[model samples]
Target chain A: MQRVNQTLGRIPPWLIYGIAAFPPVWFFWLGLNGGLGVEPIKELEHRLGELALQVLIATLAIRPLREWTHVNLLKLRRSLGVVTFAYVSLHLLVWLVLDVQILSEIWADIVKRPYITVGMAGFILMIPMVVTSNNLSLRKLGPKKWRRLHRLMYPVCVLAGLHFVMLTKGFQFEPLIYLALILVLLAARVPWNLGRATA
Target chain B: MAGRYKSDLKWSDVTPKADWINRRQLMAGSGALALGSTAGPAVASLGAQKTDWGAGLEPNTVEEITTYNNYYEFGTDKGDPAMHAHALTTEPWSIEIDGLVDQPGSYGLEDILKSVTLEERIYRLRCVERWSMVVPWVGFELADLLAMAGVQPSAKYVAFETALRPDEMPGVSYPIIDWPYKEGLRLDEAMHPLTIMATGLYDEPMPNQNGAPIRLVVPWKYGYKSIKSVVRISLVEEQPPTAWNNYSANEYGFYSNVNPDRDHPRWSQKYERRVGGGLFAKQEPTLFMNGYADEVGSLYAGMDLIENH
Candidate 1:
């Protein structure tokens, strides 16, 4: 585990970002090349949304992974969070500009559709975290307050998972699995107090 | 059977068998040619005819028609059917027409086809998911099949069932929906001229992904109302259980007619994006009864649409 930490520490944060950036670029290339099958726009939107959720999940997993396995990937969490925001923004932009072109209908969709309502709420919650992701803002707010503010990720992740579950037409297991994973990660963070005796 | 109802067709309306068969053969042969091979003469000799039903609408490409499908028995994703439905075995198929029908027995697919003439019908298929497509279907009217089976006067509804072959269908493992998807229509609606049992598309046998062998095509309703891989057609008095409605009665109703005025509880029904329309294409306003109100609107004259929906 210590060796794993040493190796992870040696890998530059830019390399992680570089690797993480490939999916969106590849998906766009697939869109341009007619490789996203028949419903390309729908396919692109689904892929972007899924990637955003996956990145957010990865960002949340970093601390738990370090706590459990002692392989600290703390340096990569901020980059992962920013990438999640980028993907979430692109996913929303696609739906707004390409999928639903009518301005009036867009408002109706966000208002009328429960899944989109929750999704929009999650997206709105994420804006502050994205704004304060940089070093300058992180120092401007003290470390403790900054950490507290970023805890909004918990609700964001839960809402994003719910959005996925509601978007499916029928009872699908894939979205439920995502929701389960998020819940499991969140459960791991609970201070069980059973370890208080040892402390 | 011959004297029951007059066909809404003239002698000249039917395409010549030889030419129709040749066109289908040519299409199949061309596909084989693209793979750097030639189809056998047997496959190259089938008949097919192209019909123009949607006058101003162009049919989606054969690739689009075959690849973009929603056969939940195969899987849920749009591409799932194309990737997984190849495992289905449609040959030697038989359909059981039971319930209130006078003739209640399993009928071989070949025997059923011999009793009817095939026609081309280009239709606009609007999915409840708000995606739409124009497809060229080749088949005979469902009413003809029902007439052959001798529908009993007591029957008020016609229920249809899809095939259940878990060995062939992988999606059945997930229970995403109850197995052997079922659908139903009112007796009059089943007898409507627009409702057909499709056997082929693009002048050839339907690709497996697009419900090979036989499928229902109720163009005026949301595409789910037109169930695929139909294996049974039963005449019943009470409203029969439908797959989607059984899953969620609140979301999917029994009479799922396409209506711009009634929104699906979760999504807008006012507009739909044409499936093959380019990425930036504008959404089109959804038409009541999917633009077939002139033909089918009178069928529900006194009933409240929102209540039935």
Candidate 2:
């Protein structure tokens, strides 16, 4: 356990951020070169959205990974959070600018479509957490208050999963699997918090 | 196996040189009758006549048209049918024409093709998903076949059904939808000169992915309205239950026309992305009745489209 943390601690979060940017860049290049298939805009949008959910799930798994497995990656959690936000933002940009290009219809869709409404809500909820993810903001807010505010991720994760589930045409299994995993992760925190409250 | 398909079959594979070089063999309905097993004058070769409907518009490339399709029996994804449709066997196909028709019997594909005059009818297909494509579909008018069947005066609607081969169609294994996909149109819509039963595209026989052997192409309506790999067509007095409408009556209506005013329950129909348009292409405003309102406007002149939609 000690060796795992010691080895991984030496790696800076900025390096992870640099590594994280590679996928979107590669996907953009593929979209440009016809490598992302005929419908590149849709492919790019789905890839970025799935990447965002994956990273966000990793953020939720960090504490459990350390406590259960003793392999700590707490140092990169904030960077991972930022990475998730970046990919989510890129996903929205592709949908707004490339997939659905009409300027007038943008706001209309965000208001009209149920899946878009849930997805936009999730994206908006991520804003404050990303802004407060910095060390300076952490110091200013203090540990207890910062932790409370960051707990907004629980609902954000749910909305993200729900957005994916609702977007699919039929009862697709893949998106439902994601939603189930997110719910399990969110639900796991409840009993521990309740036990602490009773004690 | 289904990540992305580069399409190993080239343009030559699609447009066989031998088929072109040997016109007599082509006319004789040899092994290379890519346009189904129709013989002689009944065979509708590609680019027969350029009418006003298809004057300025060019059909999408065979690659774009074939690769990106929505054959739900093959699978739900656009690329799925392209990847998995090869398993289907299209030879010795037949359709049962029944219901209120004067002549109700099982007609072999060759017999049906031999009866009708094949010609090119270029039309734009607007999918319910808000993507559009113009295809140079080579087929004959649906009215001609109905005329051969001798539609009874009591008939008010025409219902169509697609072949459901569970051994062949991967999608049928799962309960994703009700099997044996069905669709219907008003008697007038089916009888309209614009509606066609397509046999081929780009002068080649229909690919399995694009509903090989036979299919319906109602240009003004949404793509799903034109059922593919049709096996049973019935003339009935009442409107028939369509697959998508049965799935979600609130979302997918019986009409399923490409009307900009009537928005889908999930998305707006005001705009659509042209399928082959480049990655950065802008969304074009959707047309009313897919820009065929001039020809089909009279069909729905008095009816409430919004209510039907």
Q: Estimate every model's Cα lDDT from 0 to 1.
A: 0.83, 0.82
What fraction of the genuine interface contacts, i.e. the true contacts, does candidate 2 reproduce? 0.49
The local lDDT score (0 to 100) that residue B124 gets in candidate 2 is 86
- Candidate 1 Cα misplacement greater than 4 A, ranges: A1-3, A10-13, A194-199, B1-52
lDDT of 2 at A113: 91
DockQ of each model vs. true complex: 0.59, 0.53
Best-fitting candidate, measured by lDDT?
1
lDDT of 1 by residue, B116-155 (tens): 8877777889999999998877788899999889999999
As a whole number from 0 to 100, the lDDT of residue B188 in candidate 2 is: 97
Clashing pairs in 1: B20-B47, B20-B48, B21-B46, B21-B47, B21-B48
